[model samples]
Target: MKTAIVGAGAMGQLFGARLQLAGTDVVFLDTNQATIDVLNARGVTLQTESRTEHTPARAARASELDETFDLFIIFTKGFHTQAAVASIAHLIGAESCGLTLQNGLGNAERLQEYFGPSKTLLGVTDFPADLSAPGMVSSNSRGKVRLGALGNVPRLPNIAQLLDSADLHAAVEQDIRIPVWEKVAFNAALNTLSAVTGLTVGGIGADPHARGLVASVLEETLAVAGRLQIDVSRQRIEAALDNAFAHHTHHKTSMLMDREAGRPTEIDTIGGAVVRLGQDNGVSTPVLATLCELVRTAARPGDNR
Candidate 1:
């Protein structure tokens, strides 16, 4: 399949490199000239725990592209979702589909505005990709993707097959919201806490108070999910948290990385979204709400408050 990876960040580079290596024609779409130039020149380098591989890559701004694609995978930060998806409207054909394996909520809806409901796919992934430099990504672990269509469509399996062919460990879920919400719960707890406290996964796990705070955030988020009838599995989320705390101790969350770099974090979509849902559903999420604000405050450039 001919695919366009929107947002040439870490996750975008990781998936694009894998798909390109798997014989799929891939192009990266981004606004960063440095990233686009580096990718076009050096291609993409993906480093896993086992080995490092470099794949030839192509990248361009939306105005520079004149070809349509079979699929457009969005990996932009949540705040940029609308503009990012809208920027690629010219590259979307009648049969083209848009998939958002992005974090948090409301991404599929944004894609639906352009691709229509039947062509929008919503999903979650646990894959960890860290950008060591432009055109270079490193992942220490393997992760799976769970996705499904937003509207009644039969193309879900085909897309999953495409990802599986690239060794991305993709699976089709009948109810994609379950995994999506469960992941939101996990991130609501770990990502927000890490961003605020500047703590690593293991650092939070090692502290009794921090661990207790994590538990509170998780409980609050799960409650909100339950109130919304998402049926997210608490056991699964907790198990995932335990695994991360144990094995990915030194790993910094994307939110934490953003905070440290003075880049905007996804607090609005991840933590703030959950908090709003809780309020709408009459579920209390004081802890998550407070952390959301704390992360926002911390993310402000040159503030350091």
Candidate 2:
């Protein structure tokens, strides 16, 4: 398949490189000139716990490409979803599928505006990727992707097959919302708390007070999910949390990374989205709401204080 990996960030490079190495034609679509140039020049370098691999890459801005794509795997931040999808409108043919494995909610809706519901795919991934440099990504081989179509589409399994061929460990889910909400709950707790307190996964788990905050956020988010009838699994989410806290102790969440770099975090889509849903469903989420505001204030640009 001719694939376009949008965003060219850490996760983007990780997936693109793997697919390219698996013999799929992969091109990276990104707005950053430095990232585009580096990808085109040095390709992508992926480092994992076992080994490191390199794959030659092609990258360009949307305006620079004229070929239609078979699939578009979106990895852009939540705030940039609309603009990013709109920029690639010319490349989305009738048969093309747009998949958003990005964190947070509402990304699939933005894609649906361009690709339509039938051609849009929504999913979640726990794959942790860190961009050490423009074309260098570090990650562990310990994550899987769960995705499904927004509307009935027979070819959805083929998309999953394509990812599996690249060893992405993907599966087409019957109800994608469940996993998506569960992931949102997990991120709303860990990501927000870590961003606000500069705590690593283990640090939060180690501190009783921080751990209490995490539990409160998780509970509030799960309540919001329950009101929506999403049936997100609390036991599964708690087990995932326990695993992360014990094993991935030194790991810094994407939100914390963005905060430390003074870049905008995905608080709006992750934490803020849950709070909005809670309010709509008459479920109070005071803890998540407060953390959302705190993350926003902490990540504001040019804050010298």
Scored by Cα lDDT, where does model 2 land?
A: 0.91
Off by over 4 Å in 1: 301-305
Tens-digit per-residue lDDT, 12-117, candidate 1: 9999999999999999999999999999999998999999999989999998988899999999999899999878988899999999989998899999999888
TM-score of each: 0.95, 0.96
Clashing pairs in 2: none
For 125-222, candidate 2 gives per-residue lDDT tens digits of 88888888899999988788998976886678999999988889999899999999999989999999999999999999999999899899989998
Ten residues in sequence with the least summed lDDT for candidate 1:
296-305
